[model samples]
Target: MFAVTILGNNSAIPTLDRHPTAQVVTCNEQLLLVDCGEGTQLQITQYRIRRSKLRYIFISHLHGDHYFGLIGLINTLNLMGRTEPLSVYAPPELEQIIQLQLDCSGTILKFELSFVPLLPGYSGLILEDKDLRVSCFPTQHRISCFGFSIEMQKRKRKLIPEQAKAYEIPAAYFSKLQEGADYQRKDGSIIKNDWVTLSPGKAKRYVYCADTIYDVNLLPWLKDADMMYHETTYLHDLEDRAAERYHSTTVQAASLAAAAGVKKLLIGHFSSKYTELQPFLDESRPVFANTDIAEEGVSYIV
Candidate 1:
């Protein structure tokens, strides 16, 4: 199943009830770490996420809130004896920073570490696997930042058993029908593939709007998403501060999600000053009915 798990949902400073930005996107058998904030490794352990299954790590920006724990996590993976090649997608400077830390410690990684830089102001498809596709887009932040879109593709065409049987196609060849293959009957006539099979359903997508201010230009990337994660760094009452800091308020996040016609909206990146999260939900739900708090330790199925 394709889904995303929230690890550290808070913004800025870390608290007992809140954490920095971090998420785990599960694509079939593979696990993708969206952002590696501090304490993210521990959160993975607490959530029973299989670190061995992790294949990629995506750091949206260089902010400590988003990737302070990346070096530690990578070191832990090496110490855990992981031999699989792991790829990291982030700004170009991240590779240098991480390599410096590792070199200073005189530590050698057991696995191949590959880095794919996310160039500033550039946006396009970055990764494509058999089951999922990932892309990045620039976000309005103090420094160069980005957002990620994870789309789970539908590969298998729908098989209509009754239609195939009516055409005298044997059940033994049903697998071929699902693969959109034409069938040959005993009568030496070919049955058109489309007569029996339909197109696969639309793909499901999850968009992570990393850390950004209110930017409507993101609509093209977030169009009709199945689920979206937008940072709501403050309540509506603090909209001015949010704009100044290049963060978004709950109302702003919901408005974008609603305008894009996204199926669901998950808001997080709450400021440390706020303890109660109900205000965020109250403000967002009116704008977008499917809005929910991006609660830590919770997995939202996309």
Candidate 2:
């Protein structure tokens, strides 16, 4: 169930067929909304995503295309009688912005809303829930933007039923054994936990490089990631424009993914000018064979 579903993939200006940046990261039953761009609420409904499952949101920057839908979505949630608390992680200024809107409209949310401010030039682990860990890092965007790294931890060890049965351990204790607990027989003998269970597998890592220019300093965060999402706002020929705008080109995104040795790469945040997206893949796959265009409404397994 660990996967990311793209809601909007287009950059700045959204069109009828494409939209601004927004995604839903599904970690089992929980959903983390990353970058709620314009039209995000509609996209969520159109994609049949469970809005009730949404627990937290991470906004990369204060750009209109990145978070213009926040106020609308929050208001809609209240109107729909949502009572569950929700947390939003974003730039410090967003807190004031959201509060002002709420005040002007005399809106009192039915749910508990809290905001966690992400300071500029900050990079560290920001969240840890049951089996999910999220960290943030700065990206070289026009404004103080950040990227997110999500790691899904394997909490339970692989249980060996045959080994447990051979030791005459009851099936009722299998849950505890998987949690790395030892079994004690009625005769007062103890069976080691390691004898019947194997260590958990490596954690699955997913890095979202929100928006950035071609920067090699990000290699450390992207290194060996199971999957990564990097914005390719332009084609290779427009590398100059991309640099001027502090955005990334298709070739640049793929090059970084290749250098970082990530298992897979998802490229999105395409500029409105580029109606055709296949060329992006053509430019990226040569550098990283696992590169994929982040298509709206498609879920990529992490």
What TM-score, computed on C-alpha atoms, does each candidate reach?
A: 0.96, 0.98
Q: Taking the tens digit of each residue's C-alpha lDDT, what string does model 1 give over 97-129?
A: 999999999999999999999999979999999
Backbone clash pairs for candidate 1 read none
Give the clash count for model 1.
0
Model 1 — which ten-residue stretch has the worst lDDT?
171-180
Name the candidate that leads on TM-score: 2
Where does model 2 exceed 4 Å of error?
A: none
lDDT of 1 at 301: 97
